[model samples]
Target: MRYIRSIYIFCSIVTSVRSGASELPEERELTTNFSSMSLTKVPEGLTPITTTLDLSYNLLFQLQHSDFRSLSKLKVLILCHNRIQELDIKTFEFNKELSYLDVSNNRLKSVTWFSLAGLRHLDLSFNDFDTLPISVETGNMSHLETLGLSGAKIQKSDFQKIAHLQLNTVLLGLRTLSHYEEGSLPILNTTRLHIVLPVNTNFWVLLHDGIKTSKILEVINIDQKSQFTSYESQQIPILENAKTSILLLNKVDLSWDDLFLIFQLVWHTSVEYFQIQHVTFGGKVYLDHNSFDYSNTVMRTIKLEHVHFRIFNIPQESIYLLFTKMDIENLTISDAQMPHMLFPMYPTRFQYLNFANNILTDDVFKKSIQLPHLKTLILKDNKLETLSLVSHFASNTSLRHLDLSENLLQHENDENCLWPETLVTMNLSFNKFADSVFGCLPRNIQILDLNSNKIQTVPKAITHLTSLRELNLAFNFLTDLPGCSHFRRLLVLNVEMNLILSSSLDFFQSCQEVKTLNAGRNPFRCTCELRDFIQLGKYSEGMMVGWSDSYICEYPLNLKGTQLKDVHLPEISCN
Candidate 1:
């Protein structure tokens, strides 16, 4: 579905460019990248037909009222990462088509919300505004959907005004609810609300008062784990609207009864996307698996990170039973030391599973490996040494991305040990493997990372990987290009910091589709042949032979420190 949308966008952009109505040559669609220049004003000569202008990373303390008046066709304007303290009234009035404005990370004490003809998204986060300038009256921002207020100490009244807009998404500050007034949360129609309440307050009181839970479908609560303390413990009855909300709790302290209490108060919120991460608890945390049952629920995703289920001291089967009922579309349980070996003989609805940083071994993986709809799997930083291809993953053609980096899969090489070879992206970096490690690599991988493996030579197995597009063999013991003429669609080739004394340009010329090749920091013999191979652009009749200008000579004392791009001379020819 995403690929189709990308194709649609590509076709639309191509049509727009060909028709000349989108970015006309006369429009000069983009100009002035005075970013991080510390300028005090908008760059000059910004044409009227300019559709996109960036004035970010500057020291402009104030925007002139008529600064953007001339750029009437401007649709996207970036003023983020600046020290702008003020925005003059009517500053963006004339840019009728301006739809996106980012003024984040600035010194905006207060902004007079005026007319921006077609404003749809506004990011004013990390500013100095304590009060919002939202008006109850319908203004040009009627179409505004996304409003970011993170790092801004929003005043209670100002927050009420901002809530009246019925925005689709709102990002509040870290401590937005610290001084929560009982009824500060206005009757908003926000579909998604993300905020972190400080630990010092009665969070239950704020949750009960500020928010009208009916309008919220997704809630992200981030607070320090130290802020949580065991309060009254009880099992509250579930509400009828149990499945309407998706909850995300990040870096929050969990009281024994807190999770159950939140589910009770929100009626399980009919949660479809539930993620609890970075949870902190003292001593052993108990889990009543009975409290979590999604058989009759529409649970889509369940991610539990750093929440010690091992400390529960529960039965291994009991832990598996907790996830048995969930028809999870995406599941991530990291650092919990889950007994994957105890998995049931049932398939999950999961399309994505990230069980990284666990005590997964060959035996555990064989018993736990369950995939039918799985597409992207992350098994990084585990103890698995070998993967069974014939008996397991080879049959799962649905898997596309596999990350087995930083694992103990070095000495586990075998003949029938092919991974989901058809995987599009494979990350096998940071593992203990030598030159023989190529036998286990997949064939149809498009993007392959074999960095930091101490590989002395290009894998003879690469000949089988004809579908390779991007290969990262950086920080290895490689000495030369591995005859990449077979990689017809290769785009990026990185072999930096290797032990290569000489490399052939003919190999790259065959893979002409490559646009980026980094062979820097390698010991290249700077002989006559090496000098002739360094030519690019006009030196090679507009052909990109040499990709990096940083490729310097490491041998031949006379030509030692000469850049590959600057070694053009009549004497340094094929002769």
Candidate 2:
């Protein structure tokens, strides 16, 4: 037995040595819990290493040229959340193998080009960089791919230099600034720059410059929130500068006057996708008939969604040019009041019409619904008391996604409005529903918002909605929930302000697919009912982990205005 044991130990040792020799020896992945640790210059005992270092969340103030000389084969160096004031250019030079270097959340005032020649993915976001050093040239970095400089104060000159490079694919961030110089767009000859401009900066000059220089400039995204500072100006300079056929102008909140002026400029620009949003009328402030004329300009493809109109008095000539001359699809008009006569009688090519929150009754909708190829009809808050207008769209086979929220919906005519099984989303919130009236629902009701109603109990038949993903039942008097056990596909369930007991906690523990459970403002008995909540909070991917300080004990604990983690439930008693 002793001889056999010795042979076994010798064999084990031989196997271990052979395994270690066969392994491809490489440096270990650097990982340290330095988020709450104090440090100065790197960490101790990490010299002569070839590993990726993570010195984040350290209160490091300065790093000299020789601080990182030990990490010869380092690939990724993350120095984020540090108090770094200055970085030497020579410290990061000649590291050809280094790829990702994240120095975000630093106090860096400037970064020279010599410091970034070897990096491929650079993240210098949340830094206090105000100006670009002229020495830093994009042409020198021949292998750069992604560059993130968000929250850094940058000018248009920085973009112009980057555009001169031969980079075909890159990410440029310029989302924080008050102004940009004209002609600052990078002119890429062969590569496309995915530029993320500021949400409010107007890049009208950049678009024009691209059309003049870049032969491969294919996409331009001008969707941001900016009030028209210069109103009633000829758009010759903006429209004449379009090198790309696919242009997207999303959420351009121009005044009625500015919107018309821009429309006149881009009428014949041959843009395949043109979107305008938050458009409001000029309050009869400027009534010029020549400005609304469409004999000279025509939009072939346009989409006007969420256009706000305060003034209902649309002129006849303006309506004629918009509905008759222009070709549009997916036209959404929300939170606006238009005159009854302004409705289009015969549109040449319009596919979708969403007149949500308008001054149009059922009688007026019947007269104005005149699209031969209309696909979807969204008539929300037109004071619809019955389903009479739905008869007009029942035969229109293409109609889908009917939203009738915040309207008077009676329980008697639910069957009249239920037809096409292709309807995906139907919002019937803030309405009166009779008992067992939801049985005539379409098959594809994925998202249902039934908040702010007098429905006391949830009917068990609602579990038949197998495709429901999000169900909002807040602000109701629902004392019990029975059908939710079968709702396996529900992702978000909001049942706030309900009467729930401590025993009801076990019902939600096995909801495998439920990610968010908003049960705030409910009268929940403390005791062991909170045991499940406290236990489930430990799960990294479950509810209560994402919330900060919203959960409060209302009934048994009576500990209001306290965070869930800080609630001392031992003091809470049900007696």
Q: Residues 1-575, candidate 2, lDDT per residue (tens digit)? A: 00101100111232233222124255354432334377876665564444456667688888776666766776666787788876565676645567767676667666655645666766665566555432445556666665545433445656666664555444334435555455555344433333345555665554555444432332223442333434344434434544444334433444455555556655555444445444444444343545554454334445454455554455644653454445465455555564332445554455666666766555554554455555566777766655435644544445555677777765553455445556666677776654344555655668877776666665555536778788777777776432455466878878776665443432565365777777666655555656556445545355742353545555554565555556544534622
Off by over 4 Å in 1: 1-186, 200-236, 240-246, 260-270, 282-287, 305-312, 315-321, 335-342, 357-359, 387-394, 411-415, 459-463, 485-489, 505-515, 536-548, 568-575
Q: lDDT tens digits, residues 1-575, model 1? A: 01100000111232232323344455456543446687888876677877766677678887877688888888777787778887653688788888877776677776666766467767765566655445543234678776666432334565555554667766554333334444454444466665554454445644543335333433344332422234434444344423234566666565543554453354344566666777653234454646664435555676778865323344556555556445467777788775463444677666877888887776664544456777887888888766443226535547788888888766444545545645788888887777776666566779989888878875544446678899888889987765576567788888878887776676646767777677778877766656445654325453343445657777778778877666555672656
TM-score of candidate 1 on Cα atoms, chains taken together: 0.63
Looking at model 1, the pairs that clash are: 225-253, 242-269, 242-270, 243-270, 244-269, 244-270
lDDT of each: 0.61, 0.54
lDDT of 2: 0.54
Candidate 1: Cα lDDT at 287: 42
User: Residue 281, candidate 1: how far off, in angstroms?
Assistant: 3.6
